[model samples]
Target: MQPQSLQLSGIRKGFGADDVLKEIDLSVRPGEFLSLVGMSGCGKSTLLRIMAGLETPDSGTVSIGSRDVTNVDPSDRDLAMVFQSYALYPHMSVRQNIATPLRMRNLSLGARLPLIGRMTAKASVLSKIDAAVNEAADVLQIGHLLDRKPAQLSGGQRQRVALARALVRSPAAFLMDEPLSNLDAKLRAHMREELSGLHRRLGATFIYVTHDQIEAMTMSDRIALMSSGRIEQLGTPDELYQQPATVTVARFIGTPSINLLPVEIDASGRVMALGRPLGVSVPARYAGPAMLGIRAEDLRPAAGGFAVKVLRSETYGADRYVTGHLADDQAVCIVMRQAAGDPIAVNGEGLSHLVFPEQRAHLFGADGNRIETTVPARIAI
Candidate 1:
């Protein structure tokens, strides 16, 4: 299938008095993998449904390539939707299930009736449908399980069958709504890789919706991070991680969660945390109460830094996470990521000083918006 661009313009939706999607405008490139990701009730799924024609927006237009598809039926939109449920026919064999879409599209009403339908369909059409089904199954590596029923297959196998069902149609785009959520952790990880490979092979547009940032980060070419009916940030995985547009994006994108410290941007542009200069500076216009954002990996044990009383430490393979509360204020806690072999010296009082590099720090104003900063050449401490 030739990949096509998808666009949603001025989308707005509400449930009763609660607004779910508010003027969402997104454009997806042809053959690009875009993910709508966020926590529950963030409108990611609703937005995806609007694209699939499963749900209609209160206002807006959905277009495929250059054609408007806002009023088109789900089937007529030339898009295949794969749901989280793996909606397979429990009684149908994998071959029958995978062939269902092609058969429905290619056969007449009378030609769709089980055994009798087979007699009414053209020999060529039947053969074509069979070939398509077999090809899809092979692509999904499920050719060996073509004769098995959904009940006879594992979670991962059933998922492949579901994908095969969608693949057989050769749709312009695939809209997936957390299709791997039902799998175990290990299987989910493996499927992420498989999905990436499949996208490369097919070169078709894919719009994926998931609450898992890890999935979105690892698989998507670009991610639309939605929050409270708005896109908090839209960028590549690395862009979102290294330079989040808002404190919410910083908090949501990382595994350990980015460390947030209450800070003040003084009139001179120096960042102060607990009345001590953090050796960071931002625009003077941003002077006011602010927040300091730092990733765990950026914070390290340094000689003359803010003190944190060590509370806990955990090791994961080659990395170690040390969590502690600010010594000056117990309300503030910090987590630092370090190499497993790195030595951390804790005084008798179980205190360690953790400091972040000026260049790697992030500053967010009181309203949660990111504030651009400039790093000074010399340390103030």
Candidate 2:
């Protein structure tokens, strides 16, 4: 099937007096897997529903490959949506569920009944449906479960069945709204690999909506990080992680969260953290209150850096994370990579010196926007 590009322009939506989507504009490339990710009530699902023609936007247009589909019906939009719920018929077998779309589209009402329809239906139509069903089953590796009902299959198998049903249609694009949210952790991880592999094999456009940043980071070609009613940032996983445009984007995209410390710029334009000079300089224009953001990995153990008293420590196999508080009442965390030879111990009373390289730090202004700064050639560590 030929892939189609999906585009949304000037999209806005509201409920009663509350505005949900505000001037949303996004363009999805052909055969690309784009994820719309944000917390609940961020309007990611609503934007997806508009793309699927499931909901009408208050304003703006939706186009698929140059054809406007804003006002089109869901079925006529040439899009297939897989909801969070499996939405499979409990009484239908896997084969029947996979064949439902083809059957509905190709068969007449009188030709769809139990025994009478079989006699009235064209042999060519039945044969085509069977071929499509088998092909979809084979693609999903669920051919052996054709005779099983939804009640008999595992959650992952049921999800695959639902995907197969969507696959049989060969729609222009696929819109999935948290389809794997119900699966257990291990199964969800497995399904992430499966879905990514399926996208590569099919080369079909995929718009995945989820609240999980991990899901978006792992599988998407580009992530559209939605917040409130707008896209805060849209870029590849690395770009969003390493260079976030706002404090919200930085806070939302990483695991264990980025550590933010209140900072300020001295009269000499030097950045200061915990009331101590950080040996980094910002522009004279930014000589005021700021926020210093650093990832746990960047906070390394240095010989004579700022002192922090360990408050707690947690181990996860090969790594240990020590959480502590600075003398100035600022919280800090250091991720110690476990290694042989040198053994490090973290306890409630232990004191450690932590330092983050000047280049590794992120400076945000009082309004939560990133502040571009210049580092001095010489620095005291």
lDDT for each residue of candidate 2 in 1-381, tens digit (9 for 90 to 100) = 699999999999999999999999999999999999999999999999999988899999999999999999898888878889888889999999999988988999999898899899999989999999999999999999999999999888999999999999899999999999999999999999999999999999999999999999999999999999999999999999999988989899887688888899877778888877886778777888988888876776676777777776677766666677775575444343332233344335587777777887899988888887676666532
Give the lDDT of residue 48 in candidate 1.
95
Global lDDT for candidate 2? Answer: 0.88
TM-score of model number 2: 0.92
**Candidate 1 local distance difference test against the native:** 0.92
Residue 331: error of model 2 in Å?
Answer: 5.9
Q: Candidate 1 on 188-209: residue-level lDDT in tens?
A: 9999999999999999999999
RMSD of each: 1.6, 2.4
Instruction: After superposing candidate 1 on the true structure, give the runs of residues whose Cα lies further than 4 Å from its correct spot.
Output: 377-381
The Cα RMSD in angstroms, rounded to one decimal, for candidate 2 relative to the true structure is 2.4
Q: Model 2, stretches more than 4 Å misplaced?
A: 266-269, 330-349, 378-381
Q: What is the lDDT of residue 289 in candidate 1?
A: 95
